[model samples]
Target: MRRSAVLGGRYVLRSLIGQGGTAEVYCACDRVLEREVAVKLLRQASVEERDRARFADEARLLGRLSHPGLVTVLDAATSDEEPYLVMELVHGPSLADCCRGVALATTRVAAIGAQLAEALRYAHDNGIVHRDVKPANVLLAEDDRALLTDFGIARLLSASTGHTATGTAVGTAAYIAPEQVRGEPVSPATDVYSLGLVLLEALTGERAYDGSPAEAALARLTTPPPMPSTLPAGWRDLLLAMTALDPADRPTTVEAVDSLRRLAAETEPAKPGFTGRTDVGESPATRSTAGSLPGSAVVTAAAGQLRTTGLGAVSRPAGLARRAGLAWRWATAAVLALVLVLGVTLWSNTLSGRPPQRDTPAGVPDRVQKPLQDLHDAVEGDR
Candidate 1:
């Protein structure tokens, strides 16, 4: 698509932001709304009837669903020669980019997992199964909020679109669940399995199943995903259960959400000064700086920034730091006051012509007594 091409008579395409297997996403300006939005157009090469139906299905599914963790579909036109979808423009990188080759903090992983699980639960509750739940489909917003996007392969539980037939597996190879590979039916558990893989990758900084699509799919059927010994017991157990071979054994999205939230909370005490926000920016160069400072320092610095920006709550650590600083000042003042009082008392005795009291034994050896008395006299004279 050329720059400046108007779509649906209102969206002015500016530049290409992303290109997937079947669509090309562009940064566009909505002339009617006067705001920037992302426009996803079906690639010319993938303008077949099946692909068109899938694109229309995604638009309808997103329009019906509403959640903070799911990308919102603003508008769509699938019948025109240049079919396109308008969506909220997320200003950050994908989860795959954020955790490319390095494991994120445990707390950060759990928090992000919880957010995705909640989104999945919402979709499941509405009878939709997001067949594609890989890291690439998950976008991290500027504020570190994880939003699930790209429902082009999502299946409606109550109805069949006829595009995806039985025995035809349709998802990314690395993140597909075992059952999905068998060409069997899918449910919420399928999404949970994919999410488990995503979380495992985030924690280990490597794909659980690697190789070509055929090799990865076959490997999952025979070998279990390897879990690292360094992971916390809760994380290990949760991941193990979520990726169970039997879908029946896996926890529901609701259960997964609760477990993940608990896991996230468990890491909070260790981060006493953190505001629980992981600022994984749009690029690797702008990754979170929270790891560079102590937990308390991170809290203090974030609090200051929040105060200056007039955004978000600046309590807790900030308040604690202020109170501690005030107490330190008060303690120092009290010590100084006590020293001043003692000095004043000594000076007053000297000014009033009253000799300062001295502790001297009634009988002392002359040798020791002489030196002691001489030192005392010297001190008094100097005063």
Candidate 2:
């Protein structure tokens, strides 16, 4: 109802598909290229130079990033009152939609993580940090290929990426890194943390941390989530390393790619012509859901529009902000818990007139901490 047509002869608009704060995406057919495409139009009134500059900058940035998992930017133009971008139209469901009460098979989730990590690595090498890397930003193709979308909130590695005019936090709250929440300059690690969260959600069907907005912000900044071992062993180390509270402690993109590959290999069989589906027949509850398909639905031909499902539907801006705040609070609580445990241990030792044990002799290891030492050596060696 906002506007009828857009971009004139460049692309024929079919219908509005989505609307955001400053943009509206439409399903359109590219006349020149003769292909179905998604056209995103900037909705902000261009009364200020900064808005125009940022809009143009995003288009330019997207044009530079070329990857199979990333959404392809085909054309950019300004029409009537807004800027427009024509991009590849993809069909499938978002990770959020599929993330409701449903837990994806471990292999499928790892496959998605691997694809997205590769995309992030490519972007980082190109000096682009996808500030926003959440479920909604990821498109699961009909064939289950992971495709990243919505680079609108992406930050260039150089210069002041983007910020609220009134000095408020930008970027998606739940997915935003601690540095971003603290108004610090964002780095590739910021995206790494976000991607880690995505992997966690895909595996556990639960966010790492959740609470009100202030609490969530504090949580991400102060506390690290429990180890992935709390969920499953295959991906525990990988997720733990990726979500390390200290950016320096997180694994590099290459490491992430390797880890995810291992996880995928363990869960999914390696066959010459496997398309990520085994074609197992439906069980008893195939038609339980009125408007859904059976569990045994195989991945054959590409599906249609990405249906809204599960966590993806929880993307309300206000709720997102509140959730982020809540996560910060949970993080704070985690910090307090760690401190209390340390305090209790120290107090108990003090009462018993015993001092905390120091490291064993440099070359000779103590038998008590031998296993601990070995673990330390393995982790350090891996690094």
For each candidate in turn, the TM-score is 0.69, 0.66
Stretches of model 1 off by over 4 angstroms after superposition: 1-4, 268-383
RMSD to native, candidate 1: 29.4
**lDDT string, candidate 2, 210-257, tens digits:** 443344555555444433333455465566567665577677787788
Q: Which candidate leads in TM-score?
A: 1
Q: What is candidate 1's lDDT per residue for 70-183, written digit by digit as tens? A: 988899998988888899998898887777656777888999999999999999999999987877788889888999998888898988555765654556556778677555
- Give Cα-based local distance difference scores for all models: 0.67, 0.58
Off-target runs (Cα >4 Å) in candidate 2 are 1-6, 44-49, 160-168, 227-230, 268-383
Q: What is the number of backbone collisions in each predicted candidate, taken in the order shown?
A: 0, 20
Candidate 1 global TM-score: 0.69
Measured by TM-score, how close is model 2 to the native structure?
Answer: 0.66
